[model samples]
Structures are given as structure tokens and as C-alpha cells.
Target: MQKRATFRNLWLASAFIAPQLLLVFVFFYWPTAQAAYWAVTLEPAFGGGNQFVGLENFRAVFADANYWASVGASLLFAVGCTAVAVGAALVLALFADRGLRGHRLYRFTFFLPYAVPAAAVGLTFRFIFSPDAGLLAGINHVVPGLWNPALDGNDAFVLVLLGQSWKMIGYNFVFLLAALQNLPRTTIEAAAMDGAGVLRRMWDLQVPLLTPTLFFLLMVNITDSFVDSFALIDVTTHGGPARATMLMVYKIYLDGFESKDYSLAAAQSMVLMALIIGLTVIQFRVVERRVHYR
Candidate 1:
């Protein structure tokens, strides 16, 4: 039987873990407790004290049409980014997995975008898609109003989606390519020998085999989009001319900092926190099923 290594000094063991415990308490636990406190307590408008309002702040947020709009926008961003990122990365991974000449170079090039910061990606896309003095400007010059995200909410949302999804592709590509490369070679060879074409083999075999990885990417992309999109949306649209690109996180920022509605923002933060925790829990609990061949 294998024996576990024992720490001789309990104080030394505590010392080793103390930093991590401190960090978790400082960053995670502290903020969570703060948000919970603020979520239920409303400060007096005139002065002095905070009144315990229970779920009133939450009720106010739920009753707000703008908050609901932000929720819808967040949902759209999550779904759109996940779908596009997964699909595009899968296609790129499939191609890279072929091990064609210079495939290593291709893989590096494909994944390089993820190394770029989100704000940089946002700035780059913002420049490219800017209605004036951008590439879009040249086209808009010819058509007078071919594209203007500033004036259009859907356009703003699409641009935000594209910018954020573009960053996610490189991340997803690395995972997918590694997963593709690690697939069972014997099954693929058998498929090929049995006269299955590339597309057919991929569709009928490899993709189904990739189910676990795909679902993982889906959950991660959805959760990350809900948060990471703030940087992109802020740079590209600032939640837009009509609040079209306002995701839940961005809405929280607006409410808490800009509008000075701390209690309401705290409530939104709690909701967003629950959503992210739920997603993480779902990923762990639900994504554990192994794929079986009949």
C-alpha cells in the first residue's frame, strides 16, 4: 500500500497554506461577502444609515425592463460567441490536425491571436469596423450609410459578438487541435479503409468523438463571454448608442459606478455570480459523462 507523505511540522504546513488561504479570503470571500451585504441593504438617500431591504433590490432589478434587456443581450453574446467560437475552431482544428506541410506553423499562427490582450483585440476590431476613417469608412463612403454601429443596436451587438468571438476562436482552436490530434488513430484508419470520405469520417466519427471537448468549450465560452466581453464591448461600443451591447457585467458596472445605484448593482452582481457558479457547477457535474461506442 502507498503511504501518504506527512508534514512533520504543523506550523510549517500551515505556513505553506497560509498565503493561499489569505489570497482566497482577500479576493474571493471578501468580495462575495461585501456584495451579499450590499445586495440586501439600501443606504439612506438623505444621510446616516443603511436600511435592510431584504429582496427589494432584487425585485427592483427584476422589474426593470433595462435589466431584462441586459440579460437578453448577455444571453445573445454567450450563445453567439460559443457557437461561432466552437464551429470556427473545430474547422480550423480539423484542418490543422491534417498534419499538412507547415502545419506546426499554421497551428502557431492560428493560436497567436489568443495571446493578444482582450483590450488590444477590441481596439483593433474597433478600428477596422469604425464607421468613419476605417475600412468600413471606405465602403460607407461609397454607400453613404452602408454600416454604422453607432446608430444601430443590432450592428453594435454583431460587432461585439464578432470581436469577442474572434478572440475565443484561437483559445478553442488550441484545445480542439490537441483533442483532434489525440483521437484514436485505429478507429480513424478503420473508417478510412471502410471507404468513408474525409467529411463523412469527420461527421460520422471524429465529431461525435469530440463531444466531450465540444461541450466543455461550449460551457467555458459561454461563461467567459459573460465576463470577458466587457472589455471588448466597452472599447467597441461602450454598451452602445442605445444600450444594445450592454451585457450583465457591463450593466452592473453602469448601475453601481455610473448610476450610483450600489444596492441594485450589488443585486445584479449576486445574480451574475450565481450564474457563473451555476455554469461552473454544471460543467463539472454534467460534462463528466464519457462517450461510449456501441
Candidate 2:
């Protein structure tokens, strides 16, 4: 049986949650409502007045070829970062779970990246990949003009993708490591008793058991790849080299702030929000069926 606590007064209960409610209203709901309104309305870029446009902004967004290109770039960025980050995190978590030498130090060092700011990580990578004095600049010496991300569209996309992936690995590693530690040891022992090697045990036993956590991470990583990469892209590539790295989030910033098109930016932001919501719903409805919750 579950025990329940009753408040002596209804007002007291309301008072307890009032602050949190106020915060949500102020920070989340209010801004969302404003964005939704702005999406459908035309507001002067210089803040003169708002005129109800009724989807004109959205039509304009769809008609722009650059918008479609941005969508394609965002998809590539999302897939690349999610795959690399999740794969690398899983491998590192597996090794860390083995109780090997210096495991504690390794775990600490690996998770440290999560604490660092994304802007700093982007700047660091920008320098590391710079064609002229970067650590990778030696590659240019070996093959003339072959290592310049600033001038090559593919290289720019790759640099942003790698930077985003590296920053996200630590976050995925922490959760995966915790999930691994909590898994049943008897299952692993039984597998070993049956002559299953480490690789076989991990692939056949541990992976199935980890499906729930893996599914959760997949949803989170995909959504984050769409939204959380704005800072990194801004700092590193700024959607340069023919807009190869201009993700949806960065495109919104570029359109609204740089181009001074508030209504268009708001429309794009609403579209992005809808896309994330639709993807999350699909994941829960379709992907959740395969998750083995123990």
C-alpha cells in the first residue's frame, strides 16, 4: 500500500507549489505563447508594431531555398553527433565498468567534458582544426591545402559535427555507466559460466538488458542535437563555408538577429519545436515497443 500525505489546508498546498508554478509561467509558458503568436503575426523588425499575417511568415520560410538547405544540414548534424556521441560513450562506459586500473581517474576525466561550457569547447576545436597554426595544420604541409575547414564546406561540417559529439559524450557516458553498474551481476556471471567471452556476453546479454536506457538516450540525444548545438555552431563555424553547418537553431538566430527578421525566426522556431515534439511522440509510440524494461 502507498501512503499519502494530506495538507491541513488547501491554501498551504497551493502555497507550496506556487513558486514553481510562477517560474513555469514566467519562463516557459509565457515565452512559448509569445513565440507562437509571433509565428503567425508579422512584427516590424525594428519593433514598430505587430500585424496579424496568418501563416505568411511560414509560407515565406518554406519558399526560401536556404531554409531547406538548413533543414538538410540539421539532419546530417543530428545524425552524425548522435551516432558518434552515443557509440563513443557506450564504449567508454563499458571499459569504465570493468574495474580496471585507474578506472576512477578515467571516469572522472571522461565526465569532465560535460562540465565545460559548449562555447569553450567550440573555440578549442576551432583552434585545433585551424588550417594555419592548428594542431592538424601539419596535415596541410603533408598534402598542400588539404586541411582547411574555413574554406571547405565538407571540412566545416565535419569539424562542427566532431566538436558537438565530443561535448555530448560525457553526458551520455555518465548515464550509461550508472545503468551498467545497476544491472544484475548474476546474468553476466551465468553468461561467463556458459563459456561466453566478454564481447559475446556484452553483445548477447548486456545489450538486451540495456535497451531501456539506450532508448531513453536515443530520444534525448536526438532532440539535443537539434537544439543544443546552436552555441557550438555559432562559435566554431558560424554556418560558414557556404552554410554547410547552418543548423535550424543557428538559422533562426541568423535570420532573427543578423537579418533582423523577427517573424520569420519565430516561425522557424515554432517549426523546430513541432518537429521535436513529433519525433518524441514517434519514439515513444514506435521505439518504446522494442525497449526491454527490467
RMSD of candidate 1 to the true fold?
A: 2.2
User: Per-residue lDDT of 32-85 in model 2, one digit per residue for the tens?
Assistant: 999999899987757677989999999999999999999999998888888999
Residue-level lDDT of model 1, residues 224-255, one tens digit each, is 99988878877788897788998999999988
Candidates in order, TM-scores: namely 0.95, 0.92
The reply for model 2, stretches above 4 Å from the true place, is: 1-3, 44-49, 282-294
Which prediction has the highest lDDT against the true structure?
A: 1
lDDT of model number 1: 0.89
Error of 2 at 139 (Å): 0.7
Give the distance in Å from residue 17's predicted Cα in candidate 1 to where it truly belongs. Answer: 0.4
**Per-model CA lDDT versus the true structure:** 0.89, 0.88
Segments of candidate 1 deviating more than 4 angstroms: 1-3, 291-294
lDDT for model 2, please: 0.88
Model 2 per-residue lDDT at 166: 90
Poorest stretch of ten by lDDT in candidate 1? 285-294
Count of backbone clashes, every candidate in sequence: 0, 0
The true-versus-predicted C-alpha distance at residue 80 of model 1, in Å, is: 0.9
